[model samples]
Target: GESVGLHLPTLSVQEGDNSIINCAYSNSASDYFIWYKQESGKGPQFIIDIRSNMDKRQGQRVTVLLNKTVKHLSLQIAATQPGDSAVYFCAENIAGRGGADGLTFGKGTHLIIQP
Candidate 1:
């Protein structure tokens, strides 16, 4: 079961623990990646992004890594805080699909911060 009714995977970590969220994209042609964090009633907010040409990119306390060999993408957050509690999603921009805005999103993971 995927954590109750939402059918979303859940990841629980200590309030100050480092957190990593992973996603696997289907299209091998995907060239760009973006990680988003969505809180309880709000829209997904951009966290960080990485291009397929690069293996890793860092922003502030977040790091995004792209593995083209396995079509894998991951977002790592250092010293997670209570504000980090939310649903995290990864979106991919397939090459030559819909110009600049074509993004396919993966099933989100619900990140829960434990006290």
Candidate 2:
């Protein structure tokens, strides 16, 4: 009956600009967070991740920021391109829970790149 994650339905950004997607998770006990990018007809791809002990982490062109105090998380994309257009979701994993009980995912945010 409890919600695990939260997400915005859509996000629009112009080509070559930066994009920031936000998520709010309900599980304070969750220790791991991951950001995924899913293109149409394709499986979700790992973009970046952060641990509960860390507040921020960065990948090639992406950054994941976690705010445990407010159960907020965000993904930042630098110089977003049309190729970056897709649905992005945030997943939270509780420590010691694995196998069939996998990470809980957010509803996802559809990112549109305006030409």
Candidate 3:
């Protein structure tokens, strides 16, 4: 089962810093993974994705590192900013006879920023 409960939902940060959000997953058979960022009352935006065959993947200012051995994934922000304050979620998509499908999202981590 996935973790879902009344957990703290805000993270405070300075204008320029690094932020790391964490999520715990339930299913292990899931292979495809994606990290998404969602602002206040907005839809989730795709940041990056990684497959089971890959260990690490990088984007413009973000990097996604996957640890298949422990079924854990992390997203690293180069320089955190005010706009970077948002909720991040790690989704797992299991590929099987059905082909590619929708993602099962883990509980998100809220990122807050301070001036």
**Residue 80 shift from truth in candidate 1, angstroms:** 0.4
Q: Cα RMSD to native, each candidate?
A: 4.5, 1.8, 2.9
Alpha-carbon lDDT of model 2: 0.88
- Candidates' C-alpha lDDT: 0.82, 0.88, 0.75
Mark the 10 consecutive residues where model 2 has the least summed lDDT: 1-10
The residue-by-residue lDDT of candidate 3 on 27-99, one tens digit each, is 6777788888999899999898888889899998888888878667888887887889888888887765222
Clash count of each predicted structure: 0, 0, 0
Q: Per-residue lDDT for 68 in model 3?
A: 77
Error of 3 at 56 (Å): 0.9
By lDDT, the better pick of 1 and 2 is 2
The deviation in Å at residue 100 for candidate 1 is 6.7
Model 3: runs farther than 4 Å from truth?
3-8, 96-100
The runs of at least 3 residues in candidate 1 whose Cα sits more than 4 Å from the true structure, single-residue gaps closed, are: 1-8, 96-100
> Mind giving the per-residue lDDT tens digits that candidate 2 earns over 35-75?
98999999989898888889999998899999999999999
Clashing pairs in 2: none
Ranking of candidates on lDDT, top first: 2, 1, 3
Badly placed stretches (over 4 Å) of model 2 are 97-101
